[model samples]
Target: MQWRGRRQSSNIEDRRGSGGGFSGGRRGGGLRIPVKAGGGGIVTMLIVGAIAWFVFGINPLTLFGGDMGGQGSYQTSETGRAGGGVDSTPGETDNFVATVLADTETVWSTRFQEAGETYPEPTLVLFNDRVESACGIAGSATGPFYCPGDRKLYIDLTFFDQLESQLGAPGDFAQAYVVAHEVGHHIQNITGVLGKLNSARQSLPQDQANALSVRVELQADCYAGIWAHDTRAAGYVEPGDIDEALNAAFQIGDDTLQRRGQGTVVPDSFTHGTSAQRQEWFKRGYQSGNFGECDTLQGQL
Candidate 1:
């Protein structure tokens, strides 16, 4: 992905070194402990964290034990934000992300305008290690996510490293695909998919809820493909760009994660769909370039 030297998104927020931990207060070191759901439920939280870490791809450190001193208080380790501080490498990554985000904004804005609606550009918060969000306190292990509550997308650039080293999906376009996927979630949130998923989650069994999550995730993948379609048409994507993204799509699919973690496949436990499904839907979106084509829930799964 030839992303350098491109225009970045104005909605990007550089909170990479802002207040995260409590008491001492510093960047990338830890977070100011986030307010948990309730008092006296620490064990439940631990269990929740363990479950979520596996199911939702969340890291465990974001669960608890941050210093949480008042905001704007503290020191920085010599490393400086777990290596994010003053690092130009991530800055380059952010530049690429910004360009892709800008592209998404353009495409979605046009799409929305065609529908007689206004597209509100969402902010992208790039961080390292740990961060706090309206959805809850989150760490880098949570990967990239879109929070509908605050209408923002949170991502740890280090996930790019994981995508290369851990997930074996390496490339700038692959990283952009990740960003597009989250923005896809943001699109879903605005389009009422989140409410439907929430209602399903509330009423369904665990397995069924996981199934719905798979649909939601696959739809986002498709939406990302739709974004890619526009970017490609605009001459931003190269010949092998789609393949790089598909490799990424395969690497992080729920089926891949499940097989890696649990040694077997459980269809009911799949939250992000199978690798084939992800690749297929992404291809569908890229081919159709239609938002209406991303309905993962309409047909047989």
Candidate 2:
């Protein structure tokens, strides 16, 4: 968490305070889709929508065409102030985000070089309210996501506050994990996992598709752990940093979120794994720091 005065990523695209500005609503906590009805058909549709979003890392707003369930709206918190968003000035929360991004770049670039491959750095788009990507339009309520269509990561920083306040996961490292996880999705995209997934999902049943999505998300969590492993090796991670990330992985588990939201657990609707599975995959990556170990699709999930 000692990120002050470090390298900040120049790939940031700031669109805050501009036109198409934030529509202003708090999305429901956790990664699960917000289904309005608990009926079997509604649950199945929600699962399909959520899995489709995960397949390409599409923003949920774009998945539902704006109101996701149309219930439990909250205000989006700003890092600096309400009217003014993050400034380019150093030592700010936005700069901290850039620093963490730079850290991932350093780690991944080195690893890719070791493997005789060049790392294609991804641009991170910082927007408020809504933003348009090659995939489609995304609202802040969709949370942070990486769109494979454009090879970019999009975030509304206010989701960080929601991660802390609503999801009960807070800390600098937790925020770093969020960014790293999205970048993990980008890694999958570059490595062709997403491409194969896209083609395969089309021929699979809804249940099988959801299961595959879980593997995809769990692999991303493992990749995040791999990044954390590199961070530790670089002497950047401090005590309690791993705990913050682990808690984050736990808080956003599909089962945990579903139980909290509707008092029931629909295993078929789980795109992301359970809390134990998430922590386990992350720990596996952190312990080995091996790309082979993070292969959730090929190996046991």
Candidate 3:
């Protein structure tokens, strides 16, 4: 990945230094205090969380923005470093994110304009441990997610390191695919697909619900591919980038995650498509770059 000294995202809300402050642990025990859960998190954290859970075997400590899952309120302290967390230098991470986001903005804006609709740019927030959002409070553990309530994208950049180093998926395009996937969720929310899904999930069986969830995930993958296609047309993507994304899609398949989650894989419990299916759908979107081709619900699964 040739990502360095590139354009960084100005839309980012940096809060790495303002993590949940640490209070000294119990006497002689020295237990680390969990930075107040989801205080500083952004939408990207949800993506990190999901991918980390499905990809890496370990869970991250915090996320960047606040999400819809905020169970409790938290305020990131300017108080003191609980453990002197990594200083925020969003160079490569911020640059890659900005380019991808910029690409999405261009693609969606044009696509919507073609249909006589206006596309609203989504905000991306980068944080360290946890953050508060309109949806609710989320921690780094919450991963990268988009909250429909705020229309923002939250992420913990730390998750990127986890993705490449631990999760088995490496490369800038893989990270870009993750962002594109979350943005896809934001698109679904805006287009009313989420509303319909929420309604359907309430009345469906657990297995059926999982099936729909898988379709939703796969659609997001397709949308990510669509973004890639448009981005490539704009001279952003280079050789082998597509392979990184495809490998990511294949690596995080529902079957793979299920196998990791449970000793045995059960297709009925799958919330994301199998490896081959995901790769195929992503390729479909990438090759065609057509949103119409991403109709997973109406087309073959």
Q: After TM-score superposition, what is the CA distance of residue 297 in candidate 1 from its true location, in Å?
A: 1.8
- Which residue segments of model 3 deviate by more than 4 Å? 1-9, 19-90, 299-301
Residue 169 error, candidate 3, Å: 0.7
Please say which candidate is ahead in TM-score: 1 or 2: 2
lDDT by residue (tens digit), candidate 2, 1-301: 6666677777676666533322222222222223232334655344333422332133323222343332111111233212222333332567777888899899889999999999999988777656666666655655777777778787767666656655667777888888889899888889988777776776789899778878988999999999999988888776777888898888888777777667789999877788899999999999999989998998422
Q: What is the TM-score of each candidate against the true structure?
A: 0.77, 0.78, 0.75
Return the candidate ranking by lDDT, descending.
2, 1, 3
lDDT of 1 by residue, 1-301 (tens): 5455666678876566544212211224334333233233564344223323332222112112232221110011123221121223424555567778988999899999999999989988776556776656665545676666677787766566656655667666777787788888788878877766665566668888777777877898899999999998887776567888798778767667667655777777666778899899999999999888988989423
Task: Provide the lowest-lDDT 10-residue window in model 2.
Answer: 71-80
Candidate 2: list runs displaced more than 4 Å: 18-91, 299-301
lDDT of 3 at 287: 99
- Candidate 1: worst-modelled 10 consecutive residues by lDDT: 68-77
Whose lDDT is greatest here? Answer: 2
Clashes of 1: 12
Model 3, span 89-183: residue lDDT tens: 52534555766676788888899999999987887767666666676666665457776667777777766655554345666677778788878
RMSD of 2: 8.5
RMSD for each model, in Å, please? 9.2, 8.5, 10.1
Stretches of candidate 1 above 4 Å error? 18-90, 299-301
On TM-score, the candidate that comes out on top is 2
